[model samples]
Target chain A: MVGKHCILELYDCDHAKLNDEAFLRTTITTAAKRAGATLLNLITHRFEPQGVTGLALLAESHLSIHTWPENGYAAVDVFTCGDQTMPEQACELLRQELGAKNHALKSFQRETPAALATAVRHPKA
Target chain B: MVGKHCILELYDCDHAKLNDEAFLRTTITTAAKRAGATLLNLITHRFEPQGVTGLALLAESHLSIHTWPENGYAAVDVFTCGDQTMPEQACELLRQELGAKNHALKSFQRETPAALATAVRHPKA
Candidate 1:
């Protein structure tokens, strides 16, 4: 019933690596493995002149990154269910791998199954 | 620079429908289109016991949802860059499609390209 989700704003990332689609594709896969999540598939797309977006579909949940190389910023999300998935560790690893100097993180504890189920069954009128 | 991202916590979702994979896939794809995003691919997976995870790889950025049908809750992320992509509209469409009775949303203005570039070049020592 206890789980966590981290929404990350990574700034001052290495402009070069952020612009490299291959690097982002590989980095996210490694990040997911680092978090101990089973990787399902990694999808990546490189924008016209710059920027890259990568999404890692994982067995536990999902981790995604969208980078604006020209801006040296990347937005990352690591959402996992259960206690086994360590999203914070994955976020830290990515900050280091991407050479980001500053970041803002928002973390939340997902609602327990029992609590959510009850709300659905007994909706507020 | 002025773009937005919506981090949504959807509660009181339809438990039965949340477990269905096809419905989620199609819903997300349509959600992206509703946001004026060009779809790249939509990937979905059904868990062993229950729940579903769907990721929409959009040309603008990405949209993803992780459902805990057992919990009657779902986590949705709508991240899109530039003025052309309307993440709020997409989030609203999803709230309706999922039949969520209540939801919490967190929105933010992504750092501008010029601002992020400045931070990278002038890193704090």
Candidate 2:
């Protein structure tokens, strides 16, 4: 499939208290819905005395987040199979909701499956 | 952190019988273990009458997989934080375990956090 994927590495987030499992689940679900995406299923893990990690499967693609409360850092990856803009919007919502600062974000345009298969088979021969 | 990420889109696989929830959990767990990565926690979802999706949190990074039994296709994303080589090895193990064919794979090198932050701040200013 042809699509855009965004991988965001959020750093120096101010909301350490907001990085709990319950908060992440709510934030991710709301962000996905606001982006006009459907949520298939979600799983969240609470690493005791550390931080929370969450993954949400969307009908569009997927979103994964990992938090480091002690370091005031968080890593977020949002990938979509079709349109590219929604992932950026979702990241903005997340940054605003979590009060992140000194943020870092990266965008990637994924290659089509056919192109990848061709490269693999040929291998510069 | 600078690292490599491998996103694999496997197609035309013939493992319909192996796509159950239990089998996926075992296979993914085993693959991660053999890669010398630390397992944090895992969450899997079973789409009844369809297929399975799983996400494993690894100290090295993360692995997410989605299967479409009817279409004989699967999508896997493996990402690492520090070292780049482990993700590829993990993907190979997954492909072998799932008996995938006609596979397509894409590799990405994530930008450093500082670089991303600069780009965001400048934005052609």
Q: Write the per-residue lDDT of candidate 1 for residues A1-125, one digit (tens) a residue.
A: 45577888888899999988888878898899888888887888777667777888887778989887887788888887666678988899889999998998888875545553332221012
Error of 2 at A120 (Å): 28
Model 1 CA lDDT for position A99: 97
Give residue A55's error in model 2 in angstroms: 1.4
Candidate 1 lDDT at B107 equals 81
lDDT of 2 by residue, B1-125 (tens): 44467788777676564457788888888877766666676777666456567888776567888666766667788776654237777788888878877787888775444432322110011
CA deviation > 4 Å runs, candidate 2: A1-3, A15-18, A82-85, A109-125, B1-4, B15-18, B82-85, B109-125
- Model 1 residue pairs with clashes: none
Q: Tens digits of per-residue lDDT for model 1 on B85-104?
A: 88988899989998999988
Interface RMSD, all candidates in order, equals 10.3, 13.3
User: Candidate 1 falls in which docking quality class?
Assistant: acceptable
lDDT (C-alpha) at residue B57 in model 1: 82
